[model samples]
Target: MPTDASNFSVTMVIRSILYTTQQASESPYNYVPTEWVCIFFLTAYSISTAIHMGQALRYKLWWMIPTVTFAGILEIFGWSCRLWSSQSPELLRPFEMQLFGTILAPTPLVAAYFIIFGRITIHFGPQFSRLTPNMYIIVFFSLDTICLTIQAVGSVFAAEAVNEYKSPTLGGNIMLGGISAQLFAIWVYLGLAAEFFLRRKYNAPFRRQVIKFGKGQRSMSKDVQCMIYALGFCTICIIIRSVYRTVELADGWSGTVISTESYFNWLDGGFVVVAMYTLNVIHPGIYLKSVDTSLPDEDKVNLSYVF
Candidate 1:
């Protein structure tokens, strides 16, 4: 409900705005009435994202929530921009908003998961990892950051092309490069995670150490498993979204997939929204409360997670 006269007037102004463009230069063709859908996504994502932040503060899952929260907030902003695009497609601002915001949004989620993986390996025993636990954050996250910058700058270039009324192939290629790089990083991370999990599950070395130390140590705690599940679930969701974006961008701005609003909702918006909500419901803080103290005192990679 609109609160005041000014609000009502602004609403009317937005509704009245419409974009007119020729076929050759027009990038995003309006496929559906995106105004309401964008708003719905924005609202849902905000609640879940905010809840994650609140959960972190309440339960002291400090390292976990920041990146997810940031990602969620960014998605909300991106969708709001989508609404702006719905109202005025000819305007560069709205396209720019959704383009850059959505592209950069998941990078933080990647960071969150990358950080959690290090912590997870540390808790499980860093010796199980092929690369040191420290490298998890330093290597993968550095890639994520670099990939994010490339994607962001590329999106900016693509969005800004509306000013000249000419599409730029270079911008699209840069964005694709960024997306492909990020996807490559994710695949590498997944490979590392899989190898470590397999080694811990079956390898004779880690098994002998566990046996030498204690039998019960072989079975991970229920909470620890939940933490793994949450991280894995979120990561899979990011991977799904990244894959969709990669394919969509391959068609370039004028491609059928990029122009399709339903695809955006189903793939881009759906994946992240589901992930944030899923993680919120799973609640990492609940699973990881006692995890920090459980690390081996000698090789313990110290991470400040206040319980």
Candidate 2:
């Protein structure tokens, strides 16, 4: 009887220890366990985005290829970090993974946005608007860069604080705010781009005529429609992620955020990643003029013969 009692006591102690460790490791802010779910979605997203990016490269869509590639890589890395966190939630390194991923991933999306805006201006004729295509790219991307820089700096600061004091500090808040501002900028930019496209489409009699041609017109409209859809979807995904992040960090690591890991997974990993991969399915290259035939006949023949 004494032997059985001793074994039971030992088992209880071990279980208690495990439970305490788990509780300690859990994010104080979250109410649900979602690390595994986040990892799964992010991993899937990364793979899909990578595949699409490869397709973009295959078509020589130079501007978009790099952006998609960057986003894919960052997402994979970020998810890997999340996975690591799930394994050992007490470790601070996982936070660094998330920080880098969050900071770098959005840059490509911003770049993609710039390209779309530039294309719209060119399509409509730059003279029709006060802003030049190049100016739009320069101004918006510059602002994006600034926001990224601030978020990065804030993340680094937060990491440093965590490492030194074993707690998150004001840096996290700063980073959160920076990301929120970026989200705002993205929405504003999207609104402007949508307005520009609508106005331009409305004014273009040739495009309007082409649309009235029925089945054949579908091919002509596909590219423009895809571009608009991709941009709008990306903007919405980013905005949702940003809002979640703001809420997550609102308490500045004091643990007020609910469903942290799961929310990040669904909003950031799943949605953003899926939206990015969608770009590959409807790549602008499919609609843009063929690169091989861009040159004059003489040049094309010479180039083909040389190859």
Candidate 3:
């Protein structure tokens, strides 16, 4: 039903969009991604995921089945997409796959950490915690899910804008806001967790258990200490990664931080690798095995707290 002039105008608009992609100056990533690096991460994630699955099954840690295992799978998929993108830098599909996979992968890992903290709260004694074990899981998990949704929605808008040759400012701001919120949430969680320990340290009325170690001391088990340490370490790693991501996103897609593979390799991918491997070495399932077995079925510290 369009006249010839209208059809010509439509053609011109399409041509303009197409022309943007063909420009040498334009690329989703400013530089071609390194193939070997992508493969390395993919292989590492594959191994880590395999180990997590085996540990979860052997320990019957059904709660972790959905959290840690799922997170590793996401990392694998994301790196695989990165590997594909290295081969075809011009393709948007692979870039998007990697972008989303990497962005959302950490969410489950963070959730798993939250669940573990809840269990720790129970193991020590619910009396020391300001929030109930169930509430800890519920409140933080909800915050994490909300943050993830915001990032995802923002990514979709940004991608669409890129495809249309439009400025991605609005979408980028949304993403920045989401990641920033996530960073703030992590800090708050750390604060609460630290407060829990401090309460036990000072509040004599609430101090039911004292963890002692080293010099012929008799108190909390070694594995429990290790588990707590591992949780803290993994959390630190997540914080580092989160901070880096916030900065990278803030700089925008064309920003130097996003353009350089080295920064991402070390700050983003490197931190995640360390966290995942650290979990493998000090797995909650193995370390917390005694807690699970010692507690009565009804009193077990697991995801049943969710319901």
Candidate 4:
């Protein structure tokens, strides 16, 4: 019905339109999809940590269980909030989740450290160590409580002033500082605990002779090794998170750091969740009970060796 030239021109117009539309669809902004893989892994890790911590509680490892549970719950909420963010990047609700989650998660870690040292004193005679066990608990945990309180207050203030003063920056800094302090304390405490344990192990001839008689006594060494490894991993993870947060916050509210929420999700959610779940695997419920019974009452009460 139409001339050949007319038909050819019409076909060319249609093809051009289609090609333009396809190009727009393939633009970088449109093609860059959110990372759902990270979300799934974080979710799985958090759930598993929570379940394992719940099981740990049944064994009456009260100090260890509560801290692990608290950390796991915060992580679950954080990851869930992250999922919501991935679905609707414009809503901005997940910022609260990230804010509160990071602030609340580390409190339980500090508390766990306190419990470990406290229990150690109870197991080993407090007199065996240069410092009293109760003093160590009071000093370190008191500092930790103060740090947590400050960080919590900062978070609340930051949340109220969201996007105004970049409150999360200040709050996150306080939290990072608190966690850094906690990590430092852990290292110090670990050194002190280890020194005490080794001193007692080699110096106490009577106990050494007694422990050699029973094959089960080797379990004590294994338990101590497990605890050291778990605590070490926890410290490293917290330090990593703290460093990441500190750098992210250094640029303030207007920086690309806060705007790029996805980056935060990976560092905060991915690394922290994995580290926490690892700690669950070595929970005191499994190791402590098996080895604790082997120690004499005096050894058990020695606070230096308990953790």
lDDT string, candidate 1, 1-307, tens digits: 6679989888777665532334213435544336788889989988988798888799877775658888888898898887877666656677777888888899988888888788777667555667677889999989988998999889878877855667856787899899899989999999989888987787523322322322333457898898888888888888889899999889876788887778889888998898888778876677766676664564342432211
lDDT of 1 at 261: 76
Ranked by lDDT, the better of candidates 1 and 3 is: 3
CA shift of 73, model 3, Å: 1.6
* Residue 182 alpha-carbon offset, candidate 1, angstroms: 0.6
Q: Write the per-residue lDDT of candidate 4 for residues 194-268, one digit (tens) a residue.
A: 666666566532122212222322323567567757866776676676666656656565566654646665676
Candidate 2 lDDT over 1-307, as tens digits, reads 5798899999999999887566655643232235667567676766777776777778777777667677777777777776666666667678566667865686677677677667655443343334556767887878787887878788888888776765656777778777877877777777666666555556532122211212221122455666767767777777777777777777557564534555565666667766776666656666554422333455323311110
Error of 4 at 2 (Å): 23
What does candidate 1 score on TM? Answer: 0.83
lDDT of 3: 0.80
* Pairwise TM-score winner, candidates 2 and 4: 2
What TM-score, over all chains together, does every model reach?
Answer: 0.83, 0.76, 0.83, 0.69
* Candidate 4 global CA lDDT score: 0.60
For model 1, the stretches where C-alpha displacement exceeds 4 angstroms are 1-27, 30-33, 204-218, 296-307
Q: What's the lDDT for residue 186 in model 1?
A: 90
- Ordered from best to worst lDDT, the candidate numbers read 3, 1, 2, 4
